[model samples]
Target chain A: MDRRKYLELFLNESREHLEGAGKQIEILISGGTGKNATLKEFYRNLHSLKGMCAAMEFRGLTELLHAMEELLEWGRAGNSSRLLKTVGTLETGLEEVGALLGLVENGDPDPSSRTGVLKNLRSRKKSRKIDHESRRPRNSGGPSEKPEVSFPSSIRVQMESLDRLLESTAEVVIHRLRLQRSLPPASGGPPGNHQENLRQSIDRLRAEVMEIRLVPFGSIAGRLRDAALDLAKRREKRIEMEILGTEISIDRSTLERLLDPLFHLIRNCVDHGIEPRQERLRAGKKSVGRLLLLVTRIGSELRVELRDDGRGIDPALLKDRAVEGGWLTPQAADRLGKEEILRLVTLPGVSTHREPDEVSGRGVGMDVVATRIRALGGTLDIDSWPGRGTAFRMQFPLTLAILDSLLVQGKSGTYVFPLHQIESIQEVPVGELERGRNRCLRWKGAPNVDLYSLDEILGVGENPHRKGTCPVLFLRTDGSRRGLLVGSILGRRDLVLRPLGSPLETMREFSGAAILDDGGIALLLNARTLLPETPGPH
Target chain B: MTKNVLIVDDTRFIRTMLRDLLQSSGRYRIAAEATNGREAVDQYKSVAPDLVLMDIVMPEMDGIQATVEILREDPSATIVMCSAMGQEALVVEAIHAGAKDFILKPFTEERILTVLRKVLIPQAASPKGSSN
Candidate 1:
């Protein structure tokens, strides 16, 4: 690979390292014990990051991680003397790395200088030496010495190489499926059996490869907590962070993509949702504000919520802002539900703050946050009361690897509905279908969302009635409940999802495509793509 | 040579930068640097420097215990405890244990030189009684 490619890989890996550091800092701040194993793992991670950064000749990142590694190792040795200061420096260093990454992304890479801070710290360290001796009474337990860290050679593979290998494996599997179908079923019996066996083995191998791609959600939660803590400190608000369901994991790439949006949400909580100490006191709330990050696994979905008990969003003010931003009319705002009103803050270019702070307000908006959440096959929901604070809930696909999809028959092909999004499927009789306005069904006493046949949405010109298949899969997208109409229901199974090529990406209905065991392309439905707009009364 | 001072800190960059700045002071020099408490104690015995700049909290043997050891070895030894914020208690403990003085971390030239002159000057005024 070219130097540019190497730089790209460095950027990606550096991001992961920063994220890990951010999370570890959160763990430390939350009063979680720096367990020996965790510390050793963190130390090794920093050491590896430093080594790779040095090899890549990204001196700034290398130097920063080297400093952080020293701090963490000291931490491992149970040094609390200047741990907080070191943590602060590490936070700033991570920010600098972010800035450098941005520069690299924009084709202007400057590693910048750490000389100023480094010099200051060095002087402090050296000056302490004279004092270290004078204070020692001379007879003590002596010095503690430990063996050096040694790494096994087997773990030396670069992340990009791992990624490339997975991608190539996916390609080969796809091609193999194509070849198996092309062979005559009876004529190629022996060879067909061999291909079938190869397919099963490849499927198993793909599952393992996917496991390597996962990064535990605990890390993402930790980083968000750190960002929240920093903001709380800056604003002089006393807030505590606690994370639940930390052991639940997500793919590394998805977790990385989540950092920015999570940071923005926490910023909103600190800058907007959280009030000053006096304000909070007068509101009959405790002086110390509480922000809770709750992560829970709900079946196939992972939900991360940021809940703050500060001053909440005012519905009236939200209405005013929505109207001012041209997102709502006066009459329309009156009839909006509380949930609906709460979502106005998430509108593109809309902010509730009368004066935005430098940290929270930038050119890009929460629309980007929503879009990012959507891109990961996730949905974001906001709930708030007038004085009870706000909570932003982001629900993501449990994993980005192989999805268990409910394959539904479309006229041209099978559309794979991510099983996570499917609430339930029912065979609604044709007579039971409410034909007054759109394709809704009156099922089990509740009026479920109207379902649209994939043929209708894809404009495939397949008449659902002509096909004589009536299976409706209820779906929850963007906080609204809806249903998708499909020709037939194919039972759930695991599929190795593959990204669509550039040419096919314009079709937004499906997020990606995956190969089936019997050799066929099943389109993975983008559940968020088909959210239903609130209907007007007839 | 240049009034050798042994530096003990966990940060390498900090150690190197300190070495550079103190060398520029024209009155003091860094004899050796150790990244943690254990190495710091070893380096101190070997260098037998004129002064010591000790970080209060370090791996293995902290500045308090380190200060206790050095003072026991040579009561005449001049040691200054270096502390960061939230280390007030530790600094007091280190002082009680026999540290001559202390300087907070991320110190500027003024702070560094002032603390050094206060702790390193052998003939300087005693901190008003209590000598071991």
Candidate 2:
């Protein structure tokens, strides 16, 4: 194989590492906190670059990266002040790497011949270390804050997705050619099968494309764990993070947008919520703090419960902070209940931390977290017990473009409910229904659940189930279960849920409109909107 | 029939080199190429290739983790670990993870073929015309 052929691939992949490290260096120079995490990322990139350059036998690149790594590792071990002083040298070293790569790119078979850059870096590193050895070191940062992470965080357009698209295209082409023929279609012949093949192919293509847009939570779990471990190490706190439902995958865009907010939450817990090891032990708790990122699907929504067993936020502190920050008067702060006061964390400029530091708990990012979640069409709720812990539960709308929905007949016409939310469809006799203002329902060998008419909720038309019976669709939300009465259970469909634009979007009862096969449209009901929080009959 | 092979490496250079070496021998077919271990596992499951040439220290689940995952799913899977010099420790870990044989980076055509042949057909890599 030609070495130059490898050069392009080598350059593309290796440049990514170099660029990633260079970006971290820029952040460090800009006085970014999480300096430990930044340096860890820097070292990781260099280590990766070393491995690659070594394989390619690019001695100059290897030597430069190796020297840079030694200096970075030393600086990460509690000499950030020294690192601050060497930013120029580090920047020059990075530029030297770029220059070396440029030489390789220009077909220099022996880029190793130019060893001037490596020598300069080594000489400078020696002098800097000797100059810094006399001064007492400050905080001895953890060896490596972020442990080596090994999981693909982003979804790639791989052969599988491409293959599916190709197969679907081939199917459509074959069907088109078949339709072009004048011969009548054969009932069971391979030569002239129905358009079902095209339909099946199209459906498969839609599904494959959606899957491409969704990434398994486990993909990003590696970094989340890394961040948690990094913070725990830097803070010198013992924390165990358990991430459940790794199998649950969400929209790629939503996942990407969430990384920062999730990081902020983790930082908040570590900085403010979690007590140190000795503090935890003194509080009669386990020496190590426990954190859980539990994701579960409730009805049609995804609920992510982030819970940490640590020193939970004290509402009194929040009250004081709210008053001191002038966001709320002392009387107004006192008027808030425990839950309301805790929610003040999501209010801008309301932080209970004694002092603000890097990462979070400066009363800045929590509000941003809330705003971001809201922008994603999600809700955030926090509750904490001072000595116990804090639990934050975020609910996200099922924003997948393709929604599996259950179509039901109503007096207004037909509507669709997200199939995942519908627990069971039961035909309830009129006598079985405790009808009136507050309708209640009972089913054979099932727990009694409150039932309301779909018409009453939508006010689209008169009730169609006043006579004989109705099909009650059971739904389970977070901490509650209820059933809604519809004309009847029509069927199920894989709906291409199109968001209602502008004027109609204001109607929160319907999230998106599902265009039916026969020029008909079914409003995909938002289950959250329909649950009007009537006191639970249970 | 040419043995189906899946080349796994983030560095396209290594992947391309391995592909050329394996295909030039005319004994292996390139079933797929994955840039990382997660993709490797996915490709392995989907393509079910006869052999895998895996590189360690790549991003998002390195060869050792990918090897463990693949072997766990299919105990009989045949995987060949690839490492640069000074990654012998990683190679040992990969071997313990059930990779059959190993190859070094800056690959020599003969070396890769020998390792692939040995792993693919233990008795085939004989003193005679086995490599061919």
Candidate 3:
């Protein structure tokens, strides 16, 4: 076999099968012997997985699966008691196989140390079979047969092809927009009817093509559940995980990128967020802690909120830790509000855990999660009540390809702000600007909105076209509202986002670049970065 | 005459290996390739290949079941069941389901060609002398 040519396919298929079986094992462990149908499905998955491993010549994984299949066959033959006892052993064997598969994926195919596991499985199977035969002399037969399941309807497609299709559709939309701009305006009536119709049709086509890149949250939910189960088991804690809005679909790339961060957060919740059984009892809470992951789509953004009902983070402690670590001075730490203090946990290397453990406290803390979310053009908010619970609400764009932006002309150039971040735009008189050390503007309704001129923030000197009245954009960052002053509002546009590569990416002021309708590029502003640090006591 | 062959396996690696091996021999042309047994049967009907190399354990339907289904439609359809070491029972069942011959996986190029020649050119070829 030309293993290099199909190694990715083999690894992907193996991972899928193993995940399916692992999920079934979790379900069987929790639900017990009543889930006979699940057991059968689990058997089939393991059997197919064994075949793939054999074809790959992964002897350890093959032997492990074969032993598991034999044990499952015994269980299916009405020896549920024996199977129940060996479920832990089977899970351990499955993990070993997973480890071996990981090694193979990493270019090491040595299966030399599997003899101990194989011997353990073979001896257990022999002893169990003999025990069953002796107990029931007449009724000792092999597993009863079950009917085969029908084929699944869906087939896997390469992600590269889906991306190519998305790119072509985006190109078509861009061209259509360019074509519309080139046409002359209508004299009187309701504009060009044919052009409007063509635009609508192209919009629908673009939507359909984008939908092809979406995958439901349920695809990764099983793995999350498995992780929760494993962590709860290892820690001797009882955790009930509730997943909501699993039917919501996210872009495939976003889903893949989010998995690791989600894993880290869930592990943190199980390890640190949830209190131990006795601790929970002392706190007048139930013995089984609850961890909830809720996903919802609001317009073009997907909000994933993971909440754990456990001992919440103490903001005061976070502040003290920040001061001790020199990340913030004692005076500055004291001035922070409760929410601002809680946000301090996301600072690098600032773990609240007093001692580092194997699971979460090796210095890679919530800061990494925040960084990952920011990289995906998203925001993360931490809300916790010291005695109640902690909730990390993450908001991400539905897809990274295109964004709805409000284009504004700045002194440097045209800039686009993500429409979701903008609260409102208003004309503030120049005299109302409170310029005592830090710029501030009192809009009629939002009195505390700190204002900064776009030119000053971009270090582009001053806007030559500044007039008596300033157009201030009210924006929301974290929980606070701020104002951004620009030259003029150029209206809203759906722009395809292109990443600024190389030296330009080092500039945190701009998120990315987008091409306008007139064929000029506008830099998209990162509102979070633009939000001035709570103007220190001046 | 160039022979048409259908390769069936759930794993793309195995199917690709078979296709490359057969194509490199210059004796066979891949008529179709299927990931599962149902697709194998459907492609067999459409392509009517001279031979089939089928993997026994697959989703939707196994090779044995597909062999039975294909043999029922055309009794003389030539199928070589692909088996791994632990699937002796399944290999036996596949043969009974009308598979012409069987080949073990992780097979060498020589072993595969020997099996193919035994089934496809039985009168003119001997297993030991059919290398080239």
DockQ of each: 0.01, 0.24, 0.25
- Badly placed stretches (over 4 Å) of model 2 are A1-193, A211-214, A229-251, A276-282, A286-288, A295-304, A313-386, A393-399, A409-414, A435-447, A458-464, A478-480, A487-490, A498-523, A533-535, B1-132
Q: Which candidate number would show the highest DockQ if scored against the true structure? A: 3
A-chain TM-score, model 3: 0.64
Say which prediction, candidate 1 or candidate 3, comes out ahead on lDDT.
Answer: 3
* Candidate 3 lDDT tens digits, A1-538: 4556666877888888889889988988786555877776677678767777766676667767787778667666756667664565567667767887888888976453232343344445552323221121123222221112221213356688788888887777788778878989745223464566467667767788778889999999999989998999999999999999999999999999899889999998899889999999999999999999999998778999999998899777778888888898999988788768888888887767788898887446688787777667777788997768999998878888877789999877899999988888888777656553454434454555667788877778653344488788888766777888888899887788877765665455776788888899998888877666574233
Clashing pairs in 2: A150-B61, A151-B60, A151-B61
Name the runs in model 1 displaced over 4 angstroms: A1-149, A152-156, A185-192, A362-364, A406-414, A423-427, A436-439, A443-463, A466-469, A476-482, A487-524, A533-538, B1-132
**Whole-structure CA lDDT of model 3:** 0.76
In terms of lDDT, model 2 sits at 0.72
Candidate 2 reference-contact recovery = 0.42
In the predicted model 3, the residue pairs found to clash are none
Q: Which order, best to worst by DockQ?
A: 3, 2, 1
Q: Is candidate 1 or candidate 3 better by TM-score?
A: 3
TM-scores of all candidate predictions against the true structure: 0.51, 0.44, 0.53
Q: Rank the candidates by lDDT, best first.
A: 3, 2, 1
